[model samples]
Structure formats: structure tokens, C-alpha cells
Target: MSADQLLDALDPDQREVARALTGPVCVLAGAGTGKTRAITHRIAYGVRTGAYTPTAVLAVTFTARAAGEMRTRLRELDVVGVQARTFHAAALRQLSYFWPKVIGGAPSRILEHKAPVVAEAAARLGLGVDRLSVRDLSSEIEWAKVSLVAPGDYAVAAAAIDRPPPAGYDRTTVARLMEQYEQAKEGRNVIDFEDVLLYLGRILQERRDIAETVRSQYRHFVVDEYQDVSPLQQWLLDQWLGGRTELCVVGDPNQTIYSFTGATPHHLLTFSTTHPGATVVRLVRDYRSTPQVVDLANRMLSRTPAQRRREGGIELIAQRPAGPPVGFTAYGDDEAEAAGIAGRIRRLVAAGTPAREIAVLYRTNAQSAAFEQSLAEAGIGYLVRGGDRFFARREVRDAILLLRGAARARAEEPMVEAVRSVLSSSGWSPDPPSARGAVRERWEALQALVALADDLAAARGGTTLVDLVTELDERAAAQHAPTVDGVTLASLHAAKGLEWDAVFLAGLSEGLMPISLAETDAAVAEERRLLYVGVTRAREHLELSFARARNPGGRAGRKRTRFLDGIWPEEGSGRRRPGAVRGSVLTGEHDPALFEALREWRSRVAAETDKPAWTVLVDATLEAIAELKPASVSELSRVQGIGPAKIDRYGATVLAIVAAHR
Candidate 1:
């Protein structure tokens, strides 16, 4: 389907970027600017125009999900024979094909043992064996390698950043740990993630024939999220483009929030310098957001702290008022905050926002409890994002394991562990006091359920793997409802590749959002990008909320976000007051005592004005009134959220002193 066929029309910039197929084009596109569209369409147009064979073209993204999504879109566009994969995936494929020839042997087996190698290294570094998780340590090692930081260089970089090591180890230990990890990975006959790039880099640099073969195979290379290209990724790109190869990289520098992850915008911004004759393109039209949302995002970008000299900062904001201003409510505690958000979600759903269209975002996964409880109480459905979503939950994972195990007895050991988790989580109290002989014996029988699955499937004449998979899916189908309604609770990382009707960015406090540690230059820039990514994901309404404290008395210890300052920039930006956050909220923290006070005030105002409660006021306006103690309508509107529609509606009566305080 063309751009015009989609529900959302593509802007001129988007159309041009999407259709452009000539030369070394560098698109400095920001989030919500139809970047994904630009690339997919570019591929489609290339195929249609006969510039290159789809099979000869290569598309690379940062993640597996991104690669799959791009491939899906290409297939939809009828662009066939193209290969799309993560950088690692592509390198691995190339290496796999050539590993046997170069070394006169099969591929190294060390790669498969990355976990055990990391574990051993961590132990030597004095890390707490139980405390240091294999998965987390591997992730750190992978990130370091991709950033081009070797074990020898790890200490210097760690010192430069002054970042603490994973709980059990300090700098010296981590540096030593990484070194040991490198040696172990080598010994295991498997090259870890870093080795993939190193091997590929070597191929391109040491051997001209290999480099030329790859270059010939891939006529064009398209990179997504180009600003996040790490040093090693760039080196790989350099080899691929040896001499001159058509390259197109699209990214938003302001959205470059992964410097800590070893990603940098230096290459993205300096593309023309290094490539020479590179055509730099900047996209300004944001096809994703409505005008109001756009105005807020652009303003936020302009006011960001000292930013690096990078291309693709926010230029055009989408202008649409598909929804109301973002609602902000301060809660006395985490429980109250969750409850308030959950309650609002129920109301939002009842008012027509589909649960899926709404998303509840917070700083950490730990904060979802209150909201989950509230959602449960209201019968509103929601899904937590990331592996931590349900699997990370003790109660939920236990339940899921039961379903997976019982459904697929022939399944691997993960199935048995699932059942075991249920008993343990349900408090079997393994001690003799809690374990009856019958219960213990039943548990033992359950342990052998995997054998039962295989026997059952075999007896039923199920021969293929698909048969067992089908039964498993069937069992899960009979489980709880899969799709959630009302809102999705997710972390920012999990929110990628998703768009929605409304997005709630909760907990925009200083310590949480930019974080206190983000006081440095690079860290602050990343924080800005993180906020930008959150803002651009919204298809319509975007709510940015914050609280002074988790508890009113918890801390002198609390602060509103600096990002909020950008939203309601008090001083004019060469014009009248810039657009402020769009919703209403309650000012005081959640309290039953204040609820009555708030309700009584609502009743008196509703009676005199004869307007619906919402018309007379909304959550944000009331919160503003409470915070500013506005004596009149003029002052109220002047307070951040009250806009013209509000001023014209109930301007007079709202100005009256509420209780005629003497």
C-alpha cells in the first residue's frame, strides 16, 4: 500500500524521504517522522524502478524485532528477495558461511558457552556467584564489545564514566572480570558477540576478495537508527562501503540516548565529512503527532540542556488535538499513584479509549504493583512489557509455567521447572512440616510429566513437532484472556515500535527521569532523547505527568522534572506563551480527607454554573488552581494548563473566591 492508502497520510518530507533512491543519501530523521515508512517505501520504489534486485539489497536495524517488522513491511509492499537482519545476525550468517573455509575447520564452539565463560570470569573477579546473574553479565559484556571497548580498555572507559559495576564487583574487579571473560570465551571455541564484529572486520580489512564479494552481493546498505551506530558497527559499515557503496542511514541525534550502550551520533552527524559527496537530508514534518502534541515536543527539544552538535534535532511537531491535555496527579505514595493512574485508566476506557490505545509508563518495573492492583479491581485489562512483564512476576510466571508444562509435557526442562515453580511459589514449604508424603510424591510424579507429554502425543498419532506445538498453543488458548484492554504498562525500552492514542509518561521527577546521576553532559543528552522517544510514540494525545514526592513528607528530597520546565516554558519563545501540557489533574496528594474537600468544591461549582462537572473543570485545571492558588479566571488560565477554550467556558464563576476567606 502507498502512503496515501494508510489511515495516516504521509507528509511531503516523508514521501520524498521514502521515495528517494539515488546516491549516498543520509536522512537525519527524528522519531514519529515516518522513518520506518521512508525506508520500506525506499526499498519498494527501488524494486519498482529497477535500480537493484531486492535480493542484492541489505537492510539492517538495531534489534531483531525491528528487522522482522521491516521485512514484514517489505513483503507487504511486494519487495521480495531482500535480506534484513540485525548487524550481529548478518555478520553471523556471513561468518558461518565462511568460517569453515578460512580456518580449515568448523566454526568455533566457544560462542555457545558465553554464559558459562562469563560466570567463571565473574567468579574470578570476586563477584557473588548467587548475586551476579548470567544474563545481566553477558549483556554488559556484549554492550562493551559492541562499543569497541576491549577488556584491556574497559577499565579506562569505566573510570571515564565512573559507572559502578554490577552489584558484587567494583571497577578493578570488573576490569579483571572482563579480561577473564575474554580468555574464557576464546578457550570455549566460541567467539562472543564482540567476536562476530571482530571477525567480520578482519574479513573486510585483511582480505580484499572477501570484502569485494560481500560488496558485490549487497549493492546497497540501508541502516535504521543510524545515530546509535557504535564504533564496531561503524567499522563494519566502513568495510562494506569500501571505496564507494551507496549507503542510506536515518537517525535522530536528539534521540540518541544510548551513548551509555556505546552508541554515538558522531558518525551520523559527520557522515558527509567522512563519506564525501554524501547527500544530507533533514526531515521536519512529523506525521505521527497532532499539532498540539507537536508543539509541546518541539518546544521541549528547543529548551533541552546543552546538546551536542548533531543533526536531526526536533524541527517540525505534528499538530493534532485528537485528545485532551495530559493529566497530572500527585499521589502521597506509590500505592496511591498506582491507584490514581489505574482509576483514570478505567474512566478513560469507559469514555472510549481502548485499553490497548492507552499506555501507563513509569521509571521502573517495581512501580507497577499499585496500578496492577487498581487495574484488577476495576476489571480493566493490561499487559506489562518486556520479559519482566508476566514471566518476571512470581505469581504470574508460576501460573504460566503450569499452563506451559501441562500443555506440553513433551516440552523441555523449562516445562518441568514451570510446574516446580508453581508449587514452590504457592508455599509448599519444602520443610517436613509442610510436605506431606502424598504431596511430595505427587510432585515427583509431576516431574516426570515431560515423558508423559511425549507418550501422549505419540499415542495420539502426532508425529511432527508442530503437533506438540499445536497442543501447547491450544492449552494456552484455554488460559486467561491474552489481549489486555484499557492500557499497557511498559518501560520506555519496551515502548519502541509502538504507537497509541494516548501515552502516559508517569514519574517525571528529577531523580527518576533524567536521574540525579545524569548531571553530566552526555547523560543529560541521553535523558532528553529518552523523553523525545516517549513523546514521539504518541499518535494523538501525550500526557507528561510528575510528582514532587512518593510521599509528601518523604523528602525535601523531591523535585519536578526539568523536562516539565521545557513544556511550560514560562518565558515566551519569541511569541506568546508556548503550549503547555494539555490535561487536568488533582493538586494535593491522594487523601480521602481531600477527596471530600475536592468533591464538595465540585458540587458547589456544578450547582452554580449548571455545567457538567468536567466542563466546569477537568483534572489538570483543578490541579493548577490548587497549586497556583489563582485568585481569578485570568490567573487560572495564565497558570500552565488552562487554555482559551477553558477561559471562554467558565471564566467568571471560577474566578470567585471559593469560601470567601476573611
Candidate 2:
């Protein structure tokens, strides 16, 4: 391809980078600012210019979604033959292909969800378990394994940590349980997620031929979201790069939210140290948001004085504060807080926002009930996220069992064993113990529960299994019906990466937020990041509400989160204040006169409902209908906002409405 064609294919900067692709290059481009443009064009240029084969370049991203996007972008640039994959996908593919000769048998079946694994391990060890906390412990083990900590190293490092260790929640028990888990996994002849990287790393170390083959296949590698690369992942990248391959990595250090999962920003921030001659670039312009949102994000960054020189040296400023000042509400109790948020969303949609554009976020899954109830009563549509929203959740399942245990004469051994299996199945237990004594204790306890149930059956006349399960279903229905509306009520962690036009950030209380235990710096920082992620998801209006006492059981110790004090200072000027108490707000009313005027708007909108979203309806068109209230098809199309397309599809109906009102 000639220089002119390259210029036509890409903008000047992207074309320059594309043309300069003979050597390793790092492009630090901000969101939506042509990082894909440069990379894809570079691939196209290399292939077109006869310098490199498309198959020789490898494109990688943090997610499979991103990998698909990259592949599509490259095809648009006419860059062909390149392969794109997520790190996990790539590692597993490589490890599986090589595992036959490297390991004795095929890898263990992947533990897609390891929470159940941890839960079973805990129960076997005889520790009492809470499902929620059990899942979090599983998260800890995942972090360790991804960072390349072997079982031996993990046992040593976890010794000082007071948080329950997974093997058996103690030094010796944990170690033995870990060994048992490994033995079980090996017995199954399947590979878990971490095995993909750990075993792959080992294969590369041992087999020079396989390593060289991978290096040859991917001579030029591009890694997106590079700041998240763990040491183990980095080792795999090293194996692929070897001495022959060129590399480009892009990331935002401040976006390092996955550090708890063994990801580190140090690899991105210190890239120059790793390869002193590598080119580096920083992107400061943010193309994703308005100036108002951008400036507020910048202000938030200044508060992070402790950390500097972020990945790609850019902290996004929302392009602008594109919406209203963040709304803050204080409540004395939990129900009021959840209800308040639901009411705000109701009013927002009434004011013209769509239900799909709104999201309700809370600290924990437990707080979703009141909000769900309120939303349902208000006739709002919603989708809840996280945990088992189905009949299968442990809270619901165990309730069914306890109801059964109370009502029926099921054999105690089977039921107890079933409960243990359910807990393990849900990944909701502490690690189980391996010692004979511990095993005997659980088995004996289960056997004892069976004997006790038998005695209960003899004492209580006519207790039956079917009656108990039936009673349990009715109880489950009673508990589950109130939260049936599809409104998305998600925990803050699961709400990341998703954007909403309107968001309600609820339950921001001190002990509830910092959770009474986040006094340490690391925990506090994580909580802050969680809050930030929650804040950034709102593209339009964002509501922050909290309650001092959640229930009658609430103690007086609860306080407003310290975050509010910083954002909304008592000094009068720092925070925005409402005129009235503004508590318990209901849906806003539409004017009678405006309704008469907008008898015209519905005719046009209903006519266009069958058409494409982007083509048939737009905000500008609706705003125009509100202002002009045109009575005729001629009058409606006569308005500047109503163009040829509007006249074609909606002309006659809009005219009919005009005649009806007249």
C-alpha cells in the first residue's frame, strides 16, 4: 500500500504509528480515542506493506468481549489472519494442547465457580459457614493461585492472616485440606482456571521447542488493560515474547480495581524499567464523558495524593458534569432509605428517562428487599443481579430444609448430608478438615442428627415428607413474592463496567460501608475504589442515600459514611442542599395543560414504536413535540426537528391526533 492509502485508512497520528510498526511500540490512548484505530491500522499496514504476515501478530485484551471487538476492528481495517484472545482463553488453549506430554493426564475439569469448592472444603473440616463470606474466601484462593502461589507457599504466607484459611481455617488443617483438594482435582483429571497458567508456565520452562513455537506464531503482541497483568500472567507473556517478539501494552493504572485478585499496576507503571528502550506514551484527553463529569473525576483524583504516575498517566475526567449535582439523602431507617431511592427512580422515569437506563446499587445483597418491594409497588420494571435470584439460593434452599426439618421425619443422615452437599454445591463453606478425628466428628454428628430425627418421628404423630416440602414451598413463596419486579438491584462490586443513565447508590452508612472492620489502609482503599466504581457508572443523574438505623434491631452506633462528610461538608458551600426536607419524595406530577398539549406527542411516538430505536425516535424529536405541540401532520413536519423520515412514517397519525383534539 502507498502512503496515501495508509493516510486514507487512518488519521495522521494513527497512520504514523501504523507506518512505524517495524519495532516495538506502545500507544497510550484514552478511551474511545483510536487505540483500536492505531493497532488495527498498524496490522493492516504491516500486512499491506509486505513487512509482516497478519498471522504473526497477536491481539489480546482483558475480556472475551474486547477480544471480539478487536478482531472486528482489525477486519474493518482489512487486517486479516490475526488471532485475538482473552488471557484466560489463550492460556487454557495453550496449556490444554501441551498438557498431554507435560502432565501425566488431561488437566482437571475447570472449576468455573470455585465457591462451591471452598464451601465443601469448609464443611468437611467441620467449621460453621456463612455462604456470603465463604464465597469471599474462595476469591482469596483464586487471587493466590493466579499470582502463582503454590500450596506450600500459600500455607506459609496465610499463616499470619487472621482471616479464615480455606483448607481448615488453621495452619495444619488448611495445609492438609489443600492437599486433599489437589488430590480430588487430580482424581477427576480436570484443570481448574489457575492450572491453565500455572501448568502452562511450567511447560514453557521445560519445553524450549513449544515456547519457541508460540513465539514464532506471535511475533508482535498487543495487550490491552496491561496494568491488570499478574506476575504469573506476565510470566506467560514472557514465554510468548522470548527474545524475538515485539510488544505493546495499554492500561490505566488508576483503574486497577482487581488488585485484590492478584493483579498489580506495578507492571504497567514500571514498564520502562522492564524494557529500558521501549517507547512509552501517555493519554490525558478523555473522549468518553462530558466536561462536568470529567472535571469532577479529576477533582476526585487530586484526593489520591498517595499514588502517582498512573498507567498511561491518565485519570479520566468525565467530559463534563453532564448531569445534576449528586443527590444525597439521609434516612433514620433502612426501609425509608430503600423506599426513597425507589421513589426517585419512579420520578426520574416519569420525567422521561427510560427504565433500562436506571440502576439501583447497594452495599450488600441483603439490602435489596425494600428497594425491590418499593419498585414493584410503583410498577417499575427491573432486573436484579448477583447471588441466586432463583429458588436455588442457599438462604431460600436452607429455609426450605429447616422448614422440612421442623415439620417432617426425613432420615437425619441423608438430610444433613444433603445440606452439607448443598452448601458445598453453593461454594459457601470454610475449608473442611482432613484429620480422621475431624472426619469422624462430622460423620458422627450427622448420624446423631438422623437418630434424633427418628426419635422426633416417634414422638410427633404423622409427620410426612410431602407435607413438609409443601409447607416449605408456601413459606418460600411468601418470602420471594415481594421482590419479584425485574429491577436490577446489584451489589456494588458486581455493578462495575455497566453504565446507567440514572443510578441510586444506597445504604452508605459508616459501619455498613467501612463495615466496622476496614480500619486498615488496604481495606479502606478497596472500599473507596468500590465507591468510585459505583459513582462512575452513572452517565446521568446519580443519587447517594443512606440510613442510620436499618431496622428495629439497629443499634445507635451507625453513622453517615465519612465519605459524605468529605463530599458534603458542613461549611455550607461544599455540598448542594435542598430547600425543603425533601424526604419521602413521591413521583412528580405532570401538568394538566401540558398533558393536553402532549396528546400530540403520543400519536407520533406510538406510530413509531414498531420502527428502529435510533431511526424512528430521538430525544430531540420528543423535545420538539413538547415545545411546538403541533396539531397537524403538516404542522408537525413543518417544525424543523421533524424531517423527511418523520413525515414519511408518522405523518398521517400525527395529523389524525391533531384533528381529534380540534
Candidate 3:
């Protein structure tokens, strides 16, 4: 494809972003605004136009999967040699290459046995923490280390901030545990995840030659999802840049939801201030969601404080036609919410949307249990998007390795029998672990692997051990599992950069959405951004549901999310009601004043553009526009079928229409 082909799919705003490949450029790309396309094409255009050699540019992503996808896209554009990697992976690679020469014999081993080690440390501290608590502490330690908070200073730092450690544990207790965990890791001759960044940053700062070599190798840098960058990661980026500024960052501050993990939107927010004369572009066109969904998202943000929303917070303008009104469901309890979500998924799949195209998203993984039980009872197949990959699970890997050994000895054995024998020989007991929790979960995973072998063999008409082994090898290489056609179950965080035809956002109650622990204003704002992420994930259909009661108990003291206030329209006023709470219906009521005003403006814009009023803004669309009462041209253009071209032509008149009515 030619260079023009790359720019062909991009809108005018996106094209401008793609073309600006030099200097400091910040793209405040809203959800579904085609940010990935813009960045990828920018790199591609630069490489094709001889402005940049592919190897000289480096793109950093948050996840290895995201980096892989970018590399795939770059390859498709016939642009190879550009390095795309996660920060950890990049650090690990550089550390690995320079370790023997710079530090010593070898770099410290990266911590892999985190849970077990944390459990041991807690035991040593006489803390008696459960497996989950151990894991949470490990996470807390990671956050502290990456945030540059030392163990001795942990208590003070944590107390100074509103964010608390998991399990409501006091900072003093966390500090003690953190110190113990660090000592334990050092004793075990290991370094945790945060150490990767710390080590890389230290080496680069101390070893000028090594830093200079890396900087000379990669002249340009692109960081995606710049909003979720931690301070430590930003420090590493600065070290890599070494004051030579040719950086392009793409992110939406409204989507800054990982503050608890030490990520802040501050870097993205002050990009222009940090790099004076930076090109700051905002992409508001949302091509993923319908007009209705986009309007709801915009309304949600519009209710947020100005500081949280920020200056570059652009309301998304949907390019798709208005679809069905978003469903706001209030359930009697958790069970009802799960059943409601399952029923909706079944109906959507039966109607047309594939099960794979529909996702059930929640605030946390624990919320998956109710939905899982309901979906199973309804005979629905589903996959958890954020769970351990089938091939990557520890038990599954162990089982496969044992199977390989057993299959080598008995090459002619049936695959299922071979799997059974290997599992049995490997001391995999049928009885659950003595202490139930993580161990039991591991055993269950092993049993699942055995069951999978049986199912795969049966499906393939009595396959041999060799075939099963070969299948595992292929799947391990592909980093995918056996194809299980099913609906997707994912947490809101995991559902980022993904879309679904229909999405059911469960557990929208006060405690869950803001997550109870989110106490400070900043933390609460992050929680709201998390929900905004969830809201924008739906492409066509969206169902926001909340249970009145969390458990099987009756509804008592259950309250709706405060964020919903001043967002959902009330019955007759056709305006947001501040006191409106959950379980209240968002009725569609068109105000005569706004409707008349819109009609008048539509007529004027149509006359100026030499087109019919319906062409400028059709009656059905005009009705949606008036009811939505979007305050700006950016928002006015979100009214179905209004793309950038029409926005350029009739946007001013439409905004004046709503302004006159107000």
C-alpha cells in the first residue's frame, strides 16, 4: 500500500496527527478516536518518507500483548525494524545485554515466586496473612518501590496520601511487611518487578556510555497510554531520551484510572508545559460507540470537577448512528443482576451479535463468580479475558511438561490415557489440598488441564500422545489456548483497548464502582475514570446495572453511585437532575424550547450549506440532539451521522441553537 493508503482511513484530525511525526506531539485521543491508527501510521509515514529509519524509533506500550499487536500492525504496513516493547521488557533486554559487562557476573534473578515468597515473609513476621492478603501485600510493595517510597518511609508516605494499602491494613503494618518482604527477596537472591525499572534507571544514570549508546540507537520515542505511566517509568523514559526531545505521546487524561498503582496523568497533562512549543492535538471523534453511548459518557465527564476533567478533556463525537438507549437496570440483588446479564448475552447472541462480540465487564474479578454461575446454569460458554493464559498457567505448564516426558516413554499411548498416567505419576492427588485457597486453585487448574486433554482427544477422534504434545507446543508458541467460542468476561481494566457489540457493566453500586476504598477526591476521580473506561468499551449496546443487595441478603443500606447524579436525565425536565439516584428511569422527554431552537438553527445551517434541513440534521437526529442539549460544537456533532465534514460545516449553527435555548 502507498503512504496515502495509510492516511486514507484516518479522519481529518487523525491525518493531521499522523503527519506530525517530529518534535514533541501530544495527542489527547479520546476513547475509540483511532489513536492507535494515528500513532502507527505516523511511524509508518516517517519510515516510508525517509524522515526516520525504522530502527531509530522506539514505541513503548503498557502490556507485552499491546506491544506485540503494534509490531504486527507495523509489519503489515511493511515497516519493520521499529522496536515495540513494554517498559519492563525493554529494561530487561537492555539489562540482560549490558549486565555482564556493566554490573558484574549476572543480573539478579527477577522475582517469579512472589506469592510463595511473600507468604513465607508474612509467616516470618508472624502476620498470618492468607494467600490473597499475601498477594495484595506484594502488590503494595510493588507500588511503593515504583513510586520511589523507601521501606522506612512507607508509613509516612502512605499516611500522607489518601490511598491505603489493600485489606485496610494500616501503613505501619504495611511498612513492617514491606521491609520483611524486601529482606526475604534479597535473601532469596531475587528482585521484584519494580527492581527492573530501578536497576535500569540506576545503570543508565551511572553509566553514561551505556546510556549514550542506547540513546544513539533509538532517536525517537513514542509512548502509548501515557496517562497510566508511573513516575518510575517516566524517569526511565527521561533517562533514555537524555534531553534529546523527539517524543510522541498518545493518551486521554479522562482515562487515567491506575493511580493506585502509582500511575498519574500528570505527565500527559503537562506535556506542553514540559516541552514548550509542543503540538497538542485533541481527537474527539469516537468511531466505536453509538451517539447515545457517547452522549452518556460525555455527560458523565461533564459532571466531574474541572481539575479532574482537565483542559484537553474533549467530549467524544460519535461517528455511528444513534442506537438503542443505554439500559439502566436495577436488580433486587446480585443473583438477579447476574441472571439479567446472562439473559441479555443469550438474547444478543441469538439475535446476531456473536458470543465473542459481547462482553460482561465488572469492577473486579470477584464479581465474576455470580456471572459465571449464572452463565453456566444458562448453558453459556464464556472466557475470562484477564485470567492467566491456558498455556501460561503454572499447573498447566507442569502438566504439559510431565505429559511430554510420559509421552516420550509411551509414544503409542492414547493421549487421554497418557495425560491421566502422567498426572497420576506426577503425584497429582484427587483430594483437594489440606489448606484450601491458592493451593486448591492450583490443583483445580491441573485437573482442568487433564480434562482438556480428554476433551481434545475425544474431539479429534482418539488422538495419540504425539498429537497432544504437538498441539501443546504449537499453542505455547502462539501464546493462545484451544479455541473456546464463548462470551468474554473481563474486568474494566482488562477491557481497555477492546470493544464489544454489547457490554453489560455489572456492580454499579456506590461501594463497588468507587470501590469503597477510594476515599480521597483524587482516588474517587480515578474510580470515576475507571467507570468511564467501562462505559466507552461498548460499541453499540450498553447495559449499566446495579444490585440493590450485594449478597443473598435483603437490600439494606444499598446506595447507587454518586457519579450517576447530574448525568442521567430525569422524567420530564429533559435535564440532568442532581438528586436523582439509582433505580430511577432515564426517561426520554424532549423540551419544546430546545426542539424549536434546534429546528431554527438547522434551517439556517441548511440554507447556508445549500442542503435540506433534514440532510443537515434529520428529524430523528434533531430530536436526539435537542434532548441531549450538548453544549458545544464538539458535542453537537455527536448527534448521529454527523462526521467531521458536517461538523466543520454546521457545527457552529447547532451549538448556537442549543446556546440560544439555554
Candidate 4:
């Protein structure tokens, strides 16, 4: 394709980017804006116009997947020989090429994961070394390295940013651990992933001959996701540039969500100041989501604290037509929230929405258990992203093996009872662990298996232990166990760069969304941006919900996320009020006397049953019952939250109350 043909396929801003083929250019691209298209076309246009030699052009991004995408696009445009790779990939390549000539025979073997080394270092330092602690320490080490902080300077640098030490360790201890970790790596003769970048930067800085060779080969550079560049990455980019200004970078400061991994937007925000007379283009036309989603995304960022908000953030403009109104809901507890989301998903799937285009995103991986259970119970297939698969979990695997063995031994107990007995022998407990983390996660996975057994028996009468095992095997096989065909369950951080037709942002409470560990102002702001990323992932349908408590009978002390203060229904007029019961619409009117009577009866029954009042019937459902005045079991079943189970349990009593009111 000719240069003119490439420019013809781009929008106005993208065309402007393509035309600026000879200078330092920065594109502040918003979410869903075709920034990839813009930058790739710019490279193609430059190559077609003979402004850049295809072999000398290098495009850098943050992820290998992203780099592969760029290569694919460039290949389709018939522009070949451009080096498209991640920062680490590029550094590793350069390090391998120059290592033999500079200081050694061969480079050290690369460490695949820092956890084992981190654990060893922690043990040597006499620190507690649980799985979570080791993981946290590994993250802290990566953050310190990427921020260009040395072991000796870690304490002061960490304190300057109010960065808390991981796993309850003090700053001094963490600094010492960092030093010990380096020594351990050196002793093992292995370089970590971060060391790949560090070593390459040092070689480029110390060896002028090597630096010139690299600089001469890659004359033009294009960087994607520039806002997520760490200080070390920027240092490497500078070395690659060798003081030349032939560069084009693209990023959106508002979408910067990886700060916990040492990413910062300062580089992208200050690019123009560093390189004067740079051609800056703002890509605000969002071609992915509808106008409603775009507007919510804009407002979500606008309401961020002034100190935490991005300066000169780009506001997204919708390029698509209107979509469904964004949904907000509150549930009595986590189980209800999960079940409600599963129900809505079932309806959407029945109404012609593909299951693969739906997602239930949360703030943490530990939150996946409830949704996984609910989806399975509802017969909806799902795939967990950035975490272990439901059936792939160790606890689930162990329980299934135990059940299969028990079935072979001809256990005489009922299906659910026999399954519970096998699981109990393998450490399954009736109550959840008091704390959260790996232990709690294990329990939840086991509980899900038990629930699966109960559901199978209830759905199919006289289900034997053998039958339950067969059902498990079939589900494990057909749930798209490790594929992308089912509904996605992912953490917000993991959902970046991915979009869907329908998105349910679950667990939108204060502590979980902002996360209790996000103590600093900047950290909280990053959390807000994380939610913005989740909101913009939807093309049409979006729902945000939170449960009042963690467990069904637990205290309802949690509140909605403060980030939605002015945007939520209670805070804003002329908007749909958030439903107290999932999938229920409120008329905001009810018979006062009947509503009170129903609440009283709910309290009495909850006290007798040792459950929460909402478990009997939430206020919204009671209000719905009062207003609608359902007088029969059939009529009562028509109310929201009144499914077959509830109807069988409370239908007659509810109808009797309505009769008395009448």
C-alpha cells in the first residue's frame, strides 16, 4: 500500500499523526481510541514514503501480546522487517548480542520467577516465609528495581513515597532483604527479569561502541503504552535514542493502572517538556463503547480527588450510538451478589448475547469463589482469568480425586453426604477461614465442590456418588476449562486492554475496590482509574454492584465505594435507583403498614432461623410484595428474589400476610 492509502484509512487525528513522520510525536490516546491503528499506520506511512528504513524502525510496547499484535498489523499493511517487541524482549536481545563482546563468554541463565529466590532470601534473613509473604516481597523487590532504587537507598526512597513494607516488615529490614536477594541471585549465577533491563542499560551507558551500534541499527522508535513506563524503562529508551529525537510514543495517563508494579505516568505527562517542539496528538474518539458507557467513564475520572487526578487527562468522546443505562445494585451479601449476577448472565445468554462476550470483574482473585460457584449452579460456563481455573484449583482437584476413589470403593451414603465425607477427610471444613488469602481461597474452592454435589443431587433425583463424579468430569471438560469461550471472571488489573459486550463490575465496596492496602492518596487514585478501565471495557451493557457484607449472616457494615458519590442513584436525581434486590425495579412506593409488617415478620423468622433478615427477604422485595399485593403462592413467585426455593420456603406465609393486609 502507498503512503496515501495508509493515511486514507486513518481518522483525522490519526492522519495528522501519520503526516508527522519526521519529528518527536506524542499521542495521548484515550480508552477504545484506535491508538494502535494510529501508530502502526504512522510507521507504515513513513516506510511507504521512504522516510524510514523498515529495518531501522523499532516499535516497543509493554507486553509480548501487544508487540505481537503490532507485528500482525504491520504485516497486514505489507510493512515488514520492523522490530516490534516488549521492553524486556528488546533488552534481552541486545544483551545476548553484546554480552560476549563486552564482559563475558555468555549471559547468566534468566530467572523465570523471582518467588523462589525471594523466599530463599527471606529465610536467610530470618523472616517468616509464607506463600503470600514471599509473593509480596517479590513484588516489592521488582518495584524498587524498576524505580531505579538501590538496596542502600531503598529505605529512604520508600519512605519518601510513604510506601509500606510488604508482609509487616520494617523499611530497614526490607532494604536488607533487597541486598541479600541480590547476593543470592549473584551466588546462583542467574539474572532476573528486571536484571535484563538493568544490565542492558548499564552496558549502553558504559560502552560507547556498543551504544552506537544499537543506536545506528534502530534509528526510529515507536513506544506504545508510554504512560506505564518505569524510570528504568525510560532510562533504557534514552540509551536507545542516544540523544536523537526521532521517536513517536502513545499512551493515556487516565488508564495508568499498574502503579503497584512501579509504573508511573510522569514520563508520558512530561514528554513534551523533555523533547521540545514535539507533535502532540490527542485521540479522544472512542470507537469501542457506546455513548452511555463513555459518559460514565468520563465522569468516573472527573470525580477523582484533585491531588490524585491526572493533569491534562484526555476526555473520551463516544463514536458509537447510545447503549443501555449503566446499572448499579446493592446486595445483602456476597453470595446473593454472585447469584444475582449469574441470573442476569443467564437471561442475557438466553436473549442472544454470547457467553464469551460477558465478564464478571472484581478487585481481587479471592472474590472469584462466589461467582464461580453461582455460575456453575446456574449451569453457566465461565473461565477465570489471571488466576487458577475453577476445576484446576488444587483443593478442587484433591476433592475430586477423593470422590472418585470413594465412588470406586462403593460408598453406601447418599451422593451429597458421601461427597461431603470424602471432602472432609481431605481438610474441607464447614466454616470458612477467618482470614483471607490462600487459606481462605482453598476453603472456598472446596466449598464450591460441595455445592456442586448438592446441586447435582437436587437437580437429578437419586444421583449416586458415581453419577456426581461423572457430572464433575463432564463439567470440567465442557466448561471451556482453560479456554476463552465462556464468560470471563477476572480482576480489574487483569482485564486491561480487553473489551466485552456486557461487563459486571462486582464487589464495588470501599475497602475492596480501593483495596484496604491502598493507604496513600496516589494509590487510591490509581484504584479509581482501575474502575474506569473496567467501565470502559463494555460495549453496551455495564453493571456495578456491591454487597453489604462478606457472608450471609455477617454484619452489614460495608458501604458503597465513595468514588460513586455524586454519580450513584441516591446521590443524583432523575436516575434509576439502585435495586436492593438484584434484577428488581423499585417503584419508590409501597404500602407503609404492610412493608413494616413484612419487615417485622422477616426479623422474627431470621431470629428463629439464625440467619440475616435479608436472607428471608430484602427490604426491596418486601416493598415489592407490599405494593404488588401478591395473594397466592403463584403471585408471590412473580416478585423478584422469589424463586422456587424461596417459594417453597416462605411462599404461603408471605401470601397470608398479604391476605391480612387486604
Identify the candidate with maximal lDDT: 4
* Top TM-score model: 4
Cα-based lDDT at residue 245, candidate 2:
36
Ranking under lDDT, best-scoring first?
4, 3, 1, 2
Runs off by more than 4 Å, candidate 3: 123-126, 166-170, 303-310, 387-483, 549-557, 569-662
* lDDT tens readout by residue for model 1, 378-408: 6677777763432244443444455545546
Q: How well is each residue in 1-662 modelled by candidate 2, as lDDT tens digits?
A: 45358668665556666766654556655443456667777777777778778888877887777788889987776677888898889888877787786765755578777666666666677767565546555666676677777667776766554334542356566555555556656655555787787778778878999888777677888888787789888888887887553887776665666665778878887777777777766555454444334433444434432233432444442333233545766766666776777788888888988887888887656556556556766667666786544244545455456645644544443443344443343332344333222232233223322333333344454545444356446433544554333457787877855667777888888865755545567667667666766776677677777776745335545677765453432433322422111122212222324433343364345345532121333322333444445676655664433577867866775556444544
lDDT of 3 by residue, 1-662 (tens): 67788788689998998889887999999999988888998999888778899999989989988899999989988998999999999888888899898878878989875787778778887886765566677778878987889989998887787555564467888888888888888898888778888888999999999999999999999999999999899999999999987999989988887776788888999999999999988898899997668867876764322333455576666787556767777777777888988998889888989888889998766566566657766777878788764456655677788887877799887777677778875435666443322344455566655655765665577687777878768645543433377888898988988889899988888977887656678778888888999999999888887888744445456766877774443434332222121223324465657866666676576557554344455444566666777787756655554668977876777777777776
Return the lDDT, model 2, position 208: 92
- Cα deviation at 531, candidate 4, in Å, is 0.4
Model 2 segments beyond 4 Å from truth? Answer: 1-52, 100-140, 159-168, 304-307, 310-313, 390-392, 400-487, 552-557, 569-662
Count of backbone collisions within predicted model 1: 20
Better of 1 and 2 by lDDT: 1
Q: Write down the TM-score for model 1.
A: 0.70
For all the candidates, what are their Cα RMSDs to the real structure?
Answer: 14.5, 14.1, 12.3, 13.5
User: For residues 1-662, what per-residue lDDT tens digits would candidate 4 score against the true structure?
Assistant: 78788999989998998898976999989999899999999999988989999999989999989999999999999998999999999999999999999878988999999988888898898887776567777888999999999999999998998776776678999999999999999999999999999999999999999999999999999999999999999999999998999999999888899987889999899988999999999898899997568767876875322322247476666777545667888888878999999999999999999999999999877678678768877888788989886677766777888889999896677887887778887656887644334455566677767876776676677888999888788766654444446899999989999999999999999988887767778889999999999999999899999999766656899999988875676633323532233345556466778877886797688668755344566544676787788777766776755789988988888889888998
In model 3, where is the ten-residue run with the lowest total lDDT?
574-583
